[model samples]
Target: MRSLTGPTVETIIGVVVRLLADERGESEADVRDELAEGGWELPIDSLRLVEILVQLEQELGVEVPADVESARSMRSVRAFAEVVLAACTTSDGSPSS
Candidate 1:
């Protein structure tokens, strides 16, 4: 499900893993392996999540919505990457024609 005009999920996930690793002082490979196993909860709090999203927006040049669903999606790295991918594809968070 690669977006035609947006960052791929893998790219977003890589960025996320890097950010999480930097925040937690862990290696990117370690963080990525944990996420790859599934059912892994992020150790970050809401504030740190917001900071990551901000960094993502800057790095990816996409505006991530600050909303309930987005907040909920931050529970996992994959989920958050999906949200960021979605944001990259849409101007107002809706499907583009």
Candidate 2:
């Protein structure tokens, strides 16, 4: 998980929307709206969702394991934040769980 120094879910959600907008040639606000009104499905496709997670991993100095079941359930910003937090550890790299 990443070390969130700000409003965790809000910050990450903004990042996710911005990344999606950049990848899709759209505006962040549009992406945010799409995300805000969601079903179990994400605003972007599965590939884009994975890409967002990967970007978060790089930006936050965290490794979102490929086999993490919760990682596949990022239908909402808070849920995705929880997944990232679950992967957050202390000084070393082992899972804090």
Candidate 3:
């Protein structure tokens, strides 16, 4: 839910990876590679996924209510981005949905 603005998709992925590394106490590079291997190209659900979500809410000052919709939307990096960007932006972070 954080208001993250950036240029590259990799940069956004990197930010999420860094947060996972910090909270999960795992090697950042390892997490990054794991995410990449999982076809995520980023860490979406390392050990600290919930912590990262809480941090996002705190950082953004937005409440992403816990529910089935939120759960389904956070199943991957791009999905999470779409949800967060929708919560933070008007355009849903895509040209079409």
Candidate 4:
């Protein structure tokens, strides 16, 4: 396993922003607007959302419950970050049975 760095909200945001930018072939500045302009829902598709979550889980070594109800409520970047931060806060980075 790679040395686990404690995942913080900001850390997750930075990673998500970078990954979103990479996936979209855009700049971080482009992706960071949702955050800078306050919490508006991210205008992204299902495929891109999965890509971001999957990569985030891999990078953080955490398995967010696949069926989280609040996930559906994640309409924006801040919402997404809040969901992720809540997940990380609630668990110890282990697979759920």
Name the top lDDT candidate. Answer: 1
Model 4 Cα shift for residue 2 (angstroms): 5.3
TM-scores, all models, native as reference: 0.79, 0.68, 0.63, 0.74
Using TM-score, rank the candidates from best to worst: 1, 4, 2, 3
Q: For model 2, how big is the CA root-mean-square deviation?
A: 4.1
Q: For residues 1-97, could you state the per-residue lDDT of candidate 1 as single tens digits?
A: 2234456788888888898899889999998788767675666788998898888887887888888878888997878888888888785465533
Q: Using TM-score, give the best candidate's number.
A: 1
Locate the minimum summed-lDDT window of 10 residues in model 3: 88-97
Q: Name the 10 consecutive residues with the lowest summed lDDT in model 2.
A: 88-97
Give residue 24's error in model 2 in angstroms.
1.2
Evaluated at residue 52, the lDDT of candidate 2 is: 80
Question: Tens digits of per-residue lDDT for model 3 on 1-97?
Answer: 4455532335445666777788768999988788778987444444467788777656654466666776776667766655655554433344322
Candidate 2 residue-wise lDDT at 81: 67
Pull out the clashing pairs in model 1: none
* Whole-model Cα lDDT of every candidate shown, in order: 0.79, 0.66, 0.62, 0.70
Model 4 scores a TM of 0.74
Better of 1 and 3 by TM-score: 1
- What is residue 31's positional error in candidate 1, in angstroms? 1.2
Residue pairs with colliding backbones in model 4 are: 41-75, 41-76, 42-76
- Candidate 3's TM-score: 0.63
* Residue 28 displacement (Å), model 1: 0.5
- How do the residues 1-97 of candidate 2 rate in per-residue lDDT, one tens digit apiece? 4455533556666666667788889998877777666742467667877888888777667666666466565766667765665565532455543
